[model samples]
Target: MTWNCGNLSSKLATEEEYKIYVDGSYLDGKIGYGLVVLKDDKVIDELSGYVSDPDAQDSRQVGGELVATKEAIRWCQSRGIKRVAIYYDLDNIKKWATGEYKTRKPLTQNFKEFIDSTNIKISWHKVKAHTGVKWNERADELAKAGANSQGATKKNGLVDDLEEKAKKFSDYLQRRGYSVNYKGIYNSQAAKLSLDDGFQDIGHLNIYNTKKLHLVPKYHELRDKSKQSELEELWQEFLG
Candidate 1:
């Protein structure tokens, strides 16, 4: 989703109104949502819980975001609150609710319907993630905590194995005096590896289908064919 800072209105709401920051996390097949409620810029409540649904597994982190917003709306309705502001990181959270984007998936359709049926007045604000935003960061931390609470489940063992291999490969490159950063997304069936030279990115690696791996040189003009061959040989050795 595109990231943009939405307008933050100058006229702030009164103490009677609520401001809620919501986030979701997905890890190793576990999904969780976190919500932080505030009034008059003071924390009033914090909520976090795991989601155990097959549909959520398909939507991944976005599913958790939907659940968090849904929970926030319920909290406001229960307290007889009329006005509230929702701070979110994902653009679809606001787009689906405001009809700026169409909801094709069943989970998203359900979420949009829930928002449409809610009586409470809701305003949405987009916040850039991991940018030192206090409540937003807190919400992310809580979401991760909730996901960790689920522990390990009977998910895709192959994906987990691939992730472990990716980590080992990253360490192998690091030991050879190369700067490496690896990230594995469980649901995507791929791992991304970036190789840097302490100044600029030198190359990238992608493991696809959990078996096939590809290395792409970042600057083909600057690097010779021998360096590319070396990286290929190293990958082959690691795989063997």
Candidate 2:
């Protein structure tokens, strides 16, 4: 099923239209999706869950988005909403949805069918990611929470709910009057935590830094082995 809006003009939706923000979170072997339904800037409901045992071929970041989008359509249809807008942060979604991109991926093809079948006047809106948009940020946090709940890692022989930890750490920062960025990490010099505190609060930072380490094209491995500080510095530099 495709969006067959033959004569329906595309434009920014208003407050009267139901709005749903969807985001996906992925880890080593798990995927989670978060959805927030809203109207008039007030939340109507939220939904989140992990994709159980996704096939290796379908267990990708885009797979999570496809699942979430498919469910969002069903949710809107169930509500009998005549007009709705579904917001996502991925540019790739636009390409796929608009028929500008195609692949043999089962999930993508299946999602097209799902969209074509849903009976609702819908529009797709792509938003800038991790920019602190309220509902979008909440959806992201929910996705992370779902991921942690489903596939929480073992640390010191105990289950570590990194998403929950991230949420609480973000709350602490807020209570301390520290401005938390959309990624749930504070970047302000005045509010910045020490390296130890940073790692403790933002567990994903270590993952991100570690990923950067592996992305090096080799030859500089030794020099960059001790450059975690430099990596973070570069991240902050990018943020600026």
- lDDT scores of the candidates, listed in order: 0.71, 0.54
Q: Write the per-residue lDDT of candidate 1 for residues 1-240, one digit (tens) a residue.
A: 111224543243342367999999998888989999998889989998776656678888998898899778767654657778889999889889878899998788767766665556777788899999999999999898878866452265555556546655665665555655554443557666666655666666666544454322222433333456667677778787
TM-score of each: 0.58, 0.56
Error of 1 at 89 (Å): 0.4
Model 1, position 235, has a per-residue lDDT of: 77
Q: How close is candidate 2 to the true structure, as a TM-score?
A: 0.56
Ten contiguous residues minimizing lDDT sum, candidate 1: 1-10
Among all windows of 10 consecutive residues in model 2, the one with the lowest summed lDDT is 187-196
